[model samples]
Target chain A: MEIREIIISLFYLIASFLFIFGIKRLSSPATARMGNIYSAIGMLIAVVATLLNKNIVSFEYILLGIVVGSAIGAYMALKVAMTDMPQMVGLLNGFGGGASAFVALSEFYQKIGPDVAPDIKAAVAISISLLIGSVTFTGSLIAFGKLQGIVTGKVVKFPLQNQLNILLILALITLIVLAVIYPQEQIYYLTIIGISLLVGVLLVLPIGGADMPVAISLLNSYSGMAAAATGFVIDNNMLIIAGSLVGASGIILTNIMCKAMNRSLMNVLLGGWDNTASSSAVSGGKDVVIKSVDSEEAASIFDAASSVIVVPGYGMAVAQAQHAVKELMDVLEKRGISVKFAVHPVAGRMPGHMNILLAESNVPYDKLYALEDINDDFKTTDVSLVIGANDVVNPAARSNPESPIYGMPILNVDYSRTVIVVKRSMAAGYAGIDNDLFGLDNTFMYFGDAKDAITKLNNELKNM
Target chain B: MSDLFFMVYVFVLAGFVGFELINKVPPTLHTPLMSGSNAISGITIVGALVASGALHATEHATLATVLGVFAVAFATINVVGGYLVTDRMLKMFKKKK
Candidate 1:
């Protein structure tokens, strides 16, 4: 190898190290920013090294591409609100997958000819890359659409949706076989891309809005798999390493998300559109009895509380209530009441969604506890304040067997001595099930926007 | 190992490393982790560069070039946007004074 080649290899080695080191730092909040910096530097080094390599014949197109890409990326990074992080991640993941598919498509187009027969192995790799990448690209866009409300948030079910999905997969498999056999035919490749794109839309459409967290994580994994396939097509070791790492980590995250919902991977994949509220199996909910309280009265209860646990959900995100929640926590803390945040794994639109929002609100890291850690404390707590959360804190998950979310693990807010719920209405949650907790004697419903209610409560406590 | 087997070996080992590495990440960082990994997936730009920049312009070069430009642009978007967003998010988690 030439000296330049050796230097490039060394650069790549350095880049890989930085990537791994950066990811390691992400394990802790204190070091995550440094991790992001390390990874960005690594990406920059890799891009620069690839550009300087002898293989790139011209810099014009590459430079133009970089400038355009950087402008858009910077605009999005700077302008997107923290609340829209899930959609932003979805769009970026889609772009990554789309880019991989295009690379594979171009490579195949460049190599195949009427008289030429591409190597079978390379053909297989390229086909896999194109298929997986296309699916991820379109699927992620659908996810983004759902999150952004551009598409319907309800589960879109056609008469033969699952059957059609299976047919699309079968047709794709047949095309792959044909592509491998007749390497000179471009028609098969085009059809495969078209079919995969359609399949991507079909795959995500049946998932309900409530399942966006699982769908987003699954799409993240698919994007990684697509990149891995692209790496195999191009015979790039670094791409393979990075792609597989992403692919594995994404799968693990997906599993964690699924476990949080008590759902299986196959169930999510096959479009488990769970509308949990329609089934009125909660025999305990028939004799509707609810204790409704105003913010002033709730404040009095909070003031008397020795220990308080705050449970936040998607409603909190919609109301942009994290800051109010933080203020409430502070007020309680000043009064010598211990306040802890009980976070469910699938609490928000995506994995760790609540954590980022709470962090953005400047909540202390030490006060936030995962479901398992804070669950037991709810039983002994003087006040359990549920902010815009229903199903996750519902006793239905533990008591009602026929309910859609019966087996799913939930925050045991009902066990607390006094349960205060801040909600927009007594509407059922995404699971569509009425929360019996609202009807419990110990639970007091404080109706209003979560942010407004919490702020009111905070003021009430202050004046007292 | 043969070339095919070597690639498989790399893939398997890398996957194990990934699983092990991610296990330590707290739930709080899962969003940043997803965004960060999305940026890494942008490595497809290498393939894009090769596809677009042929040593000599040929009959199919125009098509390849156009596709390559798009590939590079999109991949860069992932890399740049993903990392910056992740950094911005991580910054929020800092301990309050």
Candidate 2:
């Protein structure tokens, strides 16, 4: 091998190492910033080495692309509010998918039948990249829309939707077969791309807002697989390595998220559950007895409590109550009460959303525990303060055999001595099922906007 | 070994490494970890650069050039935006003083 070629391969290897090191740093809150820096540096090394490797005939276009791309990226990155993080993540995934699709399509355009032989392997790689990439591109856009409120959060379905999706997949497979057989047919390839885009929309449309975090993670996985296929299309070793890493991590995260909710990946994809149906079903059954309390009364209970567990959810995100809750935690801690935050895996609109929210509010990392880690602690807790969270703490998941959320792992807030829930109303959660916890004798609902209620309680505690 | 076989070797090894490294990321850091990986996956910008320049010699150069420009832009957005946003999120995570 040429010395230059060997050197370039070494750069790729070095870049991969940095990427791994960067990801490893994410294990702790303290080192995560440094991890981002390491991965960015790794990306820098890879990009620079590839540009300098003597393959480019023109640098002008590359330079222009980089300048324009960097400007827009930097601007958007700086402008995005922490609250809008999920949408930003969706948009980033979409861009990655688009790039992979374009890259693979360009290669196919440059190398099909007339000049290059109809290599079946190349054909397979190209089609797979295009398929996965286009789906991710559109699916992620829809997810972004949902998070951004440009699209309705409710599941959108039509007659025979699943059947139509099946037909689309069948057609896609047939086109792949045809493309492989007649590699020169550009029209067939384009048609496949179009169909894939439609399928992407169809696939994500039926999924309700409650399942969006799972959907986002799944699309993240798709984007990784798309990049991997592009790696095969371009015969780049680094692409495959990086792509598989993202793919594998995304899959693992997605599985973790699914297990958290006790829902299979297939169920999330098929999108059958909706809040309206579940809520209606819940209200239809036996009447639920709720014990409602004012924030002042709850504050008195909180003041007397020896220990408290604060569980925040998507409603907390909606009400932007993390900071208020942090204040409440501080007030409680100052009074010699132990305070901890319990986070469900799929708590917010995306994985780790609640953690980010809590962290952003300067909640101590040591005080935050995952569901299982803190579930047992709830049993002996003086007060389980549920901040705009439902379903996740529902005892029905543990007690009711017919409950929709029956098998899902939840924060055992019901076991606490006094369960004070801060919510807007007694409405069922996104699962639409009535929470059996509300009817429990020890459960008291403090109804109001989460931020206002928590702020009031904080003040009340201070006055006490 | 065949070229494909070598690529597979890299793939399998990297897959293990990625899984192990990522599993270490606490749930609090999952968003940032994902954002960081999103940037890493933008590694395809290398191919985009090469394709754009290489296509300058072909008859369908214009089409390839357009696609290349877009690929570069999108990948850049993924890389730059992703990394920056991740840093932004991570910066917000403070250990209580």
Identify the CAPRI category of the predicted complex in candidate 2. Answer: medium
What overall lDDT, based on C-alpha atoms, would model 2 receive against the true structure?
0.85
Tens digits of per-residue lDDT for model 2, B1-97 = 2877787787788888878877777887888877878888888887888877663544556787788888998899988998998898889888778
Residue A353 miss distance in model 2 (angstroms): 0.4
- C-alpha DockQ of every model: 0.76, 0.72
lDDT of 1 by residue, A13-34 (tens): 7887787888888888888888
- CAPRI quality level assigned to candidate 1 from its DockQ score: medium
Best by lDDT: 1
The RMSD of every model to the true structure, in order and in angstroms, is 1.5, 1.9
Query: For candidate 2, what is the recovered fraction of reference interface contacts?
Result: 0.73
lDDT of each: 0.85, 0.85
Q: Which stretches of candidate 1 lie over 4 Å from their true place?
A: A273-278, B56-58
